[model samples]
Target: MRALTGTGVLTRLALRRDRLRLPLWVVGLAALFASIGNSISGLYETDAARLENAQVRADNVVTRAFTGPAPGSSTGALTVSEGLVFTCVLVALMNILLVVRHTRQNEELGRTELVGSAAVGRHAQLTAALLVAGLANVLLIVLSTLALIGMGLPAGGSALAGLALGTVGLAFAGLTAVAAQLTESARAATGLGGLVLATTFLLRAAGDAFGNTASDDITVNPAWPSWISPLGWGQQLRPYGESRVWPLALLLLCSALSVLLAVRLSVHRDVGTGMLPARRGAVRASSAMLKPIGLVWRLQRGLVLGWMVGIAVFGAVFGGIGDQVDDLFSSEKSAQFVRDLGGEGDLVNAYFAGMMGLLAVVVSGFTVQALIRLRSDEENGPTEAVLATSVSRAHWLLAHTLIALLGTALVLAVLGLSTGLAYGAVSNDLTAALGDLLETTLAQLAPTAVLAGFALAAFGLLPRLAATVTWAAFAVCLVIGQFGTLLNLPDGLLDISPYSHLPNMPAESLTVMPIVVMVVLAGALTAVGVAGFRRRSLALGG
Candidate 1:
């Protein structure tokens, strides 16, 4: 009990700090779940439509890899099968980030140490972080259930689905708590948590994709691999199918173990430090390392490599699956349905084009992260150190800015190359497949540039709130680009996103006008950011 002292105050503090951010995550996820549920429900109202949907998914390795388990012959199961994995991912992300922010970020900022110096107990901060994370997951449960039920999904299934997702989320929260204790830097903590999330996701995906398909149309069985993952455990609950409670028990047990381990580790480690020691740097910096671009590269190299590997893996999977898409939709009716959904003339071309559109948003995340490093540097005192020398503010800022631009291009190009290579291998027309994928990939860079420019501009102008502003813009763009059509949002609203303006390549004629416009917008915003940084003093904190 003594170790948990002041947990309430710190918990409230976490809530206060995350007030706006927390709500946005909750509402955004709820909206996404509700929207997907509604769309699935409305699209397939009859038994025939539902079975057809299930059959297509059951046969498609790509769908199984991403979504997991074909739905049983019921509306609720269909909704669960379509939306469960993605929604669970979102919930896990929310919990992990929330825990890391309150724990490792506070320590990185020295707040944890300061609080610990007072009447606060050794475990208070971790306890508070866990408490806040638990509360958020509970809220997710309530909101998700209500949203699904409001969309006319069966109440029992909806509630079970919500509980399953929430359990997965809380489990990851506990994992993140342990990660926070293990890593000194918040970025490292978040990265560690992300790595776990990726591992579990892959485990679950591999199990689902390679798992047994029974003779009966209704049952898709996952093997032992899926049983090894927390996500897989949650999925095994099978909200609208089996509705098992035992898996939830396993998830909760894992969460409890993770939390207990974190608490024990906390007692052994010093405040503001990690259980695992950080590595020591070289005594002298190399000439190449001293250069601004090189320095920025060193800082961002880990992230770039991670993205490259992830994209390459994803590209291979997507490309491998692209070949099966045509065969899966062999029926003329299925072909027409895909074409209608894609709004493209050729089914294969349209599929590739739609994929490029989604990849654009993904690459934007990399772009934004790269650009935000400037804000991070400024806050951490590195910018001031660099600027105090012969380097001018504009030059130093532009050095990093240039890297962000070039890095975005590099990431996109790599994605294009890998995607084209794998896709061409299977598509059989190597040249045309490579050419089309590369062309679409390059065209999508316009929107990615726009996102980087926005982050850079926000960093320059709203130094303190740069992260908030940029992330909000990113979220809006993501929602508009991904869901605008389904939601039937206004053209004006959709037009606000740079992605909306890009020509749907391979499906439609390539339009140079929009690309040029997006590039100019990106350039102009970057200039604004440079000017803002030049005029303002560095906002470093003690």
Candidate 2:
């Protein structure tokens, strides 16, 4: 039989397996892009007004650093370009993780071995995985194009924009394929792919921030640094401006090259082994691994440290941008808008509070992930072995739960301290600002605890569906908190978010009732989860 025998059969089976997931990804991504296009079109109805607003907002260094350089002559095009660039990056990341998981990870788990024995050729599995990812990317392109054109964007420009978005996904899918071949563990492959994604974003951000001119002069053009990054190339296509199609070709060529490299690597590697062999660890367990809690800490320390660092950096950047808000508020109309957003509080403080709220949501996601780790361990059968030892069920549950609670608190505190210090330095009020920011950060603990409690409860009541339920709850909360104002959702609907009950910190005085209620809810849920876990048979798989 040929190396690629049964490739078509495997491809069909993989498609059947991922029927729902791939379509959801494609539809969600396209909808998000289209929504942004619709919002921009509505907001910037006049070309002259758009141009003026773009000149100001796009020129701001912090804005430029966050979003890529401005797109076309009109403001509407610039807004669409900025929003699409980041959305495309997110879509690409989703694709990379999904594709890598199914390809290399499935094989490593021995599922592919069963298939290979059943008349499947060596290359058939890889072919099927790549085909699934490719088809999903194509759907993304088509859906995005239709959504944009439906929203009244020029059809040709809309198609180019969607193609740009899909090109990023295709490129990253290829990169992930190569990464999957290089790493023995699925986690390591995902991490390496994430690192590549982050580096690309940072490089694109740097290029956009430093490479562009803010002035109105027609003679000067932005630097060519954006041309080097794949994301930059997408923006350079200038979806609405002279709309160049060659960048998509460039992305396609790069993707083809990456695929060739991945196939070549796969040809030499063993079924379960990586191109880079796994390193040997010390034969004995570390002193830190002796206790259940200690082992939990050790296992989770790297993830917590990464979260803390990310939160700190995010805080610092947001705080640093606080100094610019006053300058931005030079317009009385904008100043009034800021005031309305935050009542009578200091504008910068309000912005800081809002930033903290957003960070709280992110920290809550970490907390949920940490708590869900217990459910994963139990379902994987490792919990059975650990429970058979001296460790009681409560001890095991507590070890993970405490980590989630304490780790989230530490992350939030560090974020508040970092932001306060940065903002204080710029505003020349270090002591007071630090105190206020820290207070606000602590206030967020209540709502975050509520989120953690929900995750724990879900794990307890529905061990099989815990992860999905936990994330879905969090997603609902996030939507209510972030978009409630813009969408004009009713107060009752918005009130479902725990953060809604907590007084806006730094801007408003702290209250004890909401905090107490949150703590009680979290405690009750955790207790129930532990009780349920003790009674139920440990689940092995979905």
Candidate 3:
């Protein structure tokens, strides 16, 4: 009872802090789910059409890897099939960020100290964070279920689908709770949780991709690896297909265990510290760590390396799957759909082009991460210390911005090169694969630069709102670029995303004009941002 003291007040405080942000998340996800069903209904009017789509999914390892098992039943199930993997990833991210923000992030910022100075118990903060996260998952279930049913999906299936998503979020929420207790830094906590999530996603993808290979018939039989992933268990619920509920018990068990462990760990740890020991750095500073660029590199090198490794792994997996694209779709509908999106080119090239496009969006995230470090440094007083030295504020800001741009380019290149090498090894066209894949991947840099530039500008012009607005902008572009066509969003609106303007290289002609324009635009925005930052006072919060 003492451990639960002030839980109600703290939960209310967490909810208040996230009022606007939480609504956007719940609404955005519900909208995405609703859009999938709504759009698919029109695109797939007949059961035959849905069955054909499901057949392609069941047959194509690449499709199955990207999505999951095709329900092969009703259109609702088909919709769930197409969107489930992405939905699970998003839900997991939402919970991780939410839990870490309330728990570790609060401690990092010293807000937890102020709260704990009151009548609050030691475990109150952790309990409140879990409660807030739990409520968010519940809201996600309620809203998403209603959205699905409102789209005229089977109520039972919709409810199960929402429950599946919610339970996954809950599991991650619990995992993140443990992560917060295990790390002294919020970023480290987030990174650890993300690693777990990435592993689970890859496991799920691997299971689905290689799932049916053992059988002669191209039927859906996810491998044993799938059983180990929470996502896999959730997918096995088969929302509209088998409509199983037993697998959800695994999620419940895992979540319960995770939360229990986190609670136990919280009991052992001191406030403002973690169960994991912090690494000690050298007392002496190297010459390389003295300069602003060098210092920025030192601070950001780990983050960049982490992203590069993740991108490289993703690239290898994507490239290895290229062979599966050859005549993978026999149906005219599936082939034409690929053709329409990929241009009149080799199917494998089209697949690579789409993958590179996705990688482009992903690299933009890296860019944002690198650029946002400037804000963190500012808030934490490091920037002021650096500026007090020989370095000018503009130079300090510009150095990080440059790192963001160049680091992202390097990461993208690695992705392209890794994908090229892997795909070439499998396809036996090493030289051509290397050149084409590199070109396609580099072509995405223009849009990625635009996103980074925009984030920098937001940082300069609106310091307080920089993080929120920049991420929202990225989200908007991501939705527009990725799902605009599927959602039937207007062409004029879709054109707003810089990704929409980039040439779909390898599949189509690599035009120079649009890319050139985007680059120039990015430069202009960066210049404007730097100038604005020079004029603005520092935004430092304790």
RMSD of 1: 2.4
What stretches of model 3 exceed 4 Å from their correct place? 38-49, 52-56, 59-66, 209-219, 321-336, 344-350, 482-492, 540-542
Q: Against the unseen true structure, what C-alpha lDDT does each candidate score?
A: 0.82, 0.76, 0.84
lDDT of 3 by residue, 228-328 (tens): 99889889888887788999899988889999999999889888899999988899988987889999988888888988898997798788768876444
Which pairs clash in model 3? none
Among these predictions, the greatest lDDT belongs to 3
lDDT string, candidate 2, 1-542, tens digits: 48789888878887887777677778988988887777566555566645655665556665665665456646337545558777867877777877776777787678877787877777777777788888888888899999888877788888888888888888888888899889987777887787777777766767766764635621113355666667776766777767788888878877898888988998998888889988798899888787888889876887798788767867886776678876645455545445544445788766666667777887888888888888767855367888999999889988888887889889989988998998898889999989989888878888888888788777777887888788888888777875576577999998888887877677788899999998898788888887877777777332
Per-residue lDDT of model 1, residues 341-388, tens digit only = 455687877777777778768888888888887887887748878888
Winner by TM-score? 1
Q: What is the TM-score of each candidate against the true structure?
A: 0.94, 0.91, 0.91
The model with the greater lDDT, 2 or 3, is 3
Error of 2 at 209 (Å): 2.1
Q: How close is each model in CA RMSD to the real structure? A: 2.4, 2.8, 2.8
**Cα distance off (Å), candidate 3, residue 385:** 1.3
Task: Looking at model 3, report the run of 10 residues with the lowest lDDT sum.
Answer: 211-220
Q: Is candidate 1 or candidate 3 better by TM-score?
A: 1
